[model samples]
Target: MTSGYGHGLDRDRDPLRRYLSAWIGFSAGGHFSQALSVAIVLYAFSTQSVRALMGWPGSLAVLGTLVVLATLSLVGGRHHIEWHGILPVSLIALFGFMGLSVFWSEYTWATVGGVAYAVGFGALGIYLALGRDLVQVVRAFGDALRILLVVSLSLEVLSGLLIDQPIAFLGIQGNLAEGGPIQGISGTRNYLGFLATLAVITFAVEFLTRSVPRRQAVASGALALTALVFARSPATAIAVIVLIVAGVALNALRRAPESRRSLMQSVFAVIVVLGGALAYAGRSRLLDAVDATNDLSVRSLLWARIRELAAVHDIVGWGFVGQWPTEIFPYSTIIAPSGRPHETGLNAFFDIWLQLGLVGGLLLVVAGTLAFVRSWITASGHPIVAYVWPALVLVLIGVTAVAESFVLFEGTLMTFVAIATIAARKRSWRSRLPQAAGR
Candidate 1:
């Protein structure tokens, strides 16, 4: 039998075969795959816009459709898939624990829905990581982010310049005319800043890899930086600084002689550890420098309340509702100082502990740590510039996760899953096992 294409007959001779071949190709890694990836990224990131425009049901419908399409795409492309040890065990354990929470959750229905929601996005992430090469993944990310950033800025212009009034539905405060703290379509300035930072990393990587024209990459990078500046997020400011340091460290490691690379890595690790200690010791000053004291003060209060609540169910947690179900008992009880219901625990670690318990929190930390370690190792050793994207992105996500639980939700969760899976596929010990027969 033939291994690929035609299946022994000329595709043109058999219309059904031609169509099937086209479908398979499209689903596997052709333009359809890329387009689907962009759609997923765009939808994941613009969830607020969807929710605002179409309501919860509509947003759920869109998510469900994307999941279904991702599944079909994976299945249709199954022959092209390398199924052996494709998923990271750490992620598997984490999600498995989330599913287990269903058995103990007071809100069983909510747990079920949350697990399903997370799994759907997880599946899409896996498809993205497995179906496309790293460069393709980066390109898809770049395309989606370009659209999001451009639209966000355009809307800001409309709200702040054209109409000179807030677009309340989309959360545009018409603040761009004042040089912004603009939220864009992300619903909050911090999230907009986070997305902008991601764009900058992705665009820079694209330029380094020569994936697109140098001019286009530079313009995209500039646009992302502009958004980051206008968003005025202190957390993002810190993340940008961390990213620059990580970038430099990675560059140095990659360029070191093979014999000294390991030693250099050790030195870098020591430096990072000492730097972290110093940062913590000077935390007050750092926060003041970033103008983040007010924000941290608010979060401190919220976190204190969450800690008290978490102690009530310290081991297993209130039970894994991915996003805080605001109407629920404990979550409903935890209101902000402004009398607004808190949507998340603000910190991903805190959110995990609150919902999934200490065990789940540990699992999350393990998963993230393993992913970062593996990606960092791969990036430092791999000659291709494309490999650096995952490592740097993990840094962005990890740093941002300190103050925002976006890592637990749609876009960020999906990206994390994809990066984790990609790194695992490259460096997993299980790769030594004999290949499985079929996907």
Candidate 2:
């Protein structure tokens, strides 16, 4: 009997390992590939020659999202089917309504894109909820996020070598008003802060997994990549700082004095390396090149527009990604090259409200926040906090959008929601186990 029990344990362990390995591989490949995809998109839009031909294209992310979702529909079908049981019914209905809204919306393409995006994310939520095991899913997510940090760092290095511009990986136009570059894989400056926070989470996972010194060194290197952005993007820097402080405080509360020592030491080392890099970068002329873009004040203008836009079309909403009245809508409120705002849609919640109406928008907020917070709690103690950080970062980005929009791009929203669903599913699974006799 003892021998049979031990063998059963081994059998279960093997399947778990296999699942974890596959999940990690998929996540890592997806992360790096996403970076490459972003670079291609940015390079296409930024070039003057291309711009003349593309004619603004009105949210390339949305188009790209449609293409990705369509592709995933075929390849991801099996995965989607597997997740159907776990997804929330209300989200599905909302997406249906969004799709229907396209018929009446002035911006048909935007409406189509919005509905498609909502559907894609809704699908992912289902997958996370019913199709996968939570612990394995998170472990895989951690592994993948760690790889993403490496990929992001690699791109930064590559960009530096190619462009010879410090902080150019951020893709910032180097204008004081710009705050930071818009490197796709690395993301915008504030996005970089989100990325760095992921790195921090990765470091935590690495420690949890008992990684070697070499891995630690790699993570340290990744953290240093954000040094350039820290000085340039107050938003990103502030967010990163706050998260770091929060993480530390949380750990202090959770850990014993002696156990906390190692984490503190590791964190201090990261700060030293990243801080030194920032000090050096701050002195360079490159630091002054962030003025042309409208990152900092763009949100104010966007907020004003949202309020104005919402007032007239307040009830029915304006369809997803629909246009606002630029003339009476406070176009001048935006800071940029006549029309170039670093990130035009400064707020996401407002965008949703404007497009979906007050009732729909409120429901989405409640549902989305619930999903995010629930996922964070379910996955926090697990190994997936690394990848989960990016989703959470999206949540933070969404918060800022209370006045403005976010990755409402088709499959992106679904991707994170899918993660949330998986987290929620895992929580339920854990709850099913019987406690040992007494509490």
Candidate 3:
């Protein structure tokens, strides 16, 4: 409506105002920069051998802390930690309980150290959630996993063709040098497999629900699938299958009536519990029937022996330290019995029970299950960008929890934290719907 002369005057007079406008738009640190920090941490862990030497872990923690603090400074302290509803409380209780266990911990300093990592990672998740939307969070992880996969593939090639021997210093195991499963840069077949599975699902969500470029998403998905096939891990394969089933089930559940959805959830829970009980009760017969080895592929025997060890501290657990000290009770027990030290329980629930006892383990189960249900329900019937990414990833995580310790382990713990944080952000549904629909 303004005259041409007035428009020219406006442009001429608003130079500093234009700069301020751009600065205001950018003051929040746009999506990709936030994604970059996450990607760096992810890639750092995948190539931890090099990162350890460079002290990247400490540096990342400091950097994340500074970013979080700076953001808080800009947006007032009280508003900074304002996490979503009751879900975070349960998680905080779980972590706080773990931290408090240090008082009774056999290895006090070790618990202190583990607690430090938990707190640091938890804070990072808060920062990530506070800064970005659910869709952005998914992209951050997708970008991180994409870069890490490329690094993994490249390192494997380098290790096989350029170096004949194991690069133990960098944790490169010359996986491609041999004909066995390609461990990628993760150094272990299972670890690489797990990471690849995560990548597959993350990229899948981005491709299906978000507006990622078709070529890029397709290429990323292919890379993840290639890694999955090359890694040749049964656990990873199982996780992928579960993701498929979950995605289909979730799609159907989304379409079903609310009453049916509620009933279906209950039925699913009952079946899972009953199925687990039946599997455990008949494991020996099942093993024999399958012509399994004496060790049942080296897991059953370990599990059986670990149970006896667990009974020693079965009530309250051995306390939440980073690792079972080889010289301590549980770890030391196996050294005498089997002539080797034991590290983990091999099963996620068992591992938690081993560290935090039945009480803590039960608490973790409740927290995780409630969080999963909350995320699923809140995200239900919402657009893809709102629900599909998190709901699917939670499915992968929940299913894998049966066999793997990704929930508590270092490399994937942040992934879990980010999921939990996003799931906790319930208010985002209403606030983000319009913006999401526009996308």
For model 2, what is the alpha-carbon lDDT of residue 114? 49
Flag the better candidate by lDDT, 1 or 3. Answer: 1
Which window of 10 residues has the lowest lDDT sum in candidate 1? 1-10
Q: Could you give candidate 3's per-residue lDDT for residues 1-439 as a string of tens digits?
A: 4698899988887997787655444544554446544653564346354454557566456545545543543343334344435236667778878887788777777778777766666655655566666777777778878878898788777777786666666666776756547776676776787888878877877887754898999999999988887787656665675677667767777787877987877776796688668867986775465343343456656677667766777867777864455777656765433667865565677777777778778878876776687677766656554477767777777766765666775555666666776776763344455677799
lDDT of each: 0.91, 0.48, 0.67
Q: Give the TM-score of candidate 2.
A: 0.57
Q: Which 10-residue window of candidate 3 scores lowest in summed lDDT?
A: 70-79
Ranking by TM-score: 1, 3, 2
Query: How many clashes show up per model?
Result: 0, 34, 0
Number of the predicted model whose TM-score against the real structure is largest: 1
- Output the worst ten-in-a-row residue range by lDDT, candidate 2: 40-49
Residue-level lDDT for 183 in candidate 1: 96
Q: How well is each residue in 1-439 modelled by candidate 1, as lDDT tens digits?
A: 4555665466546897677667656676577888998899899899999999999899999999888778768877888778888799999999999999999999999899999988878888888898788999999999999999999999999999999999999999999989999999999999999999999999999999999999999999999999999999999999999999999999998988888989988999999999999999999999999899999999999999999999999999989888889998889999998887899988999999999999999999999999999999999989998999999999999999899998887889999999999999998878877654243
Better of 2 and 3 by TM-score: 3
Q: Is candidate 2 or candidate 3 better by lDDT?
A: 3
Candidate number that wins on lDDT, 1 or 2: 1
- Candidate 2's residue-wise lDDT over 1-439, tens digit each? 9999999999999999887656444533444334433332333222322233354464345445534543443243344444323444445555665776787677676567546545644554343334334333333444444554455555555445456554433453333223334343444555444445544554454555444366764655455455435425544444444455545633543343555655765675587468657855762332234341344455565666668867766776766543332432233244344555333355556666667678667666665665565554543444444434434444444433442243454323544465545544554343443453345
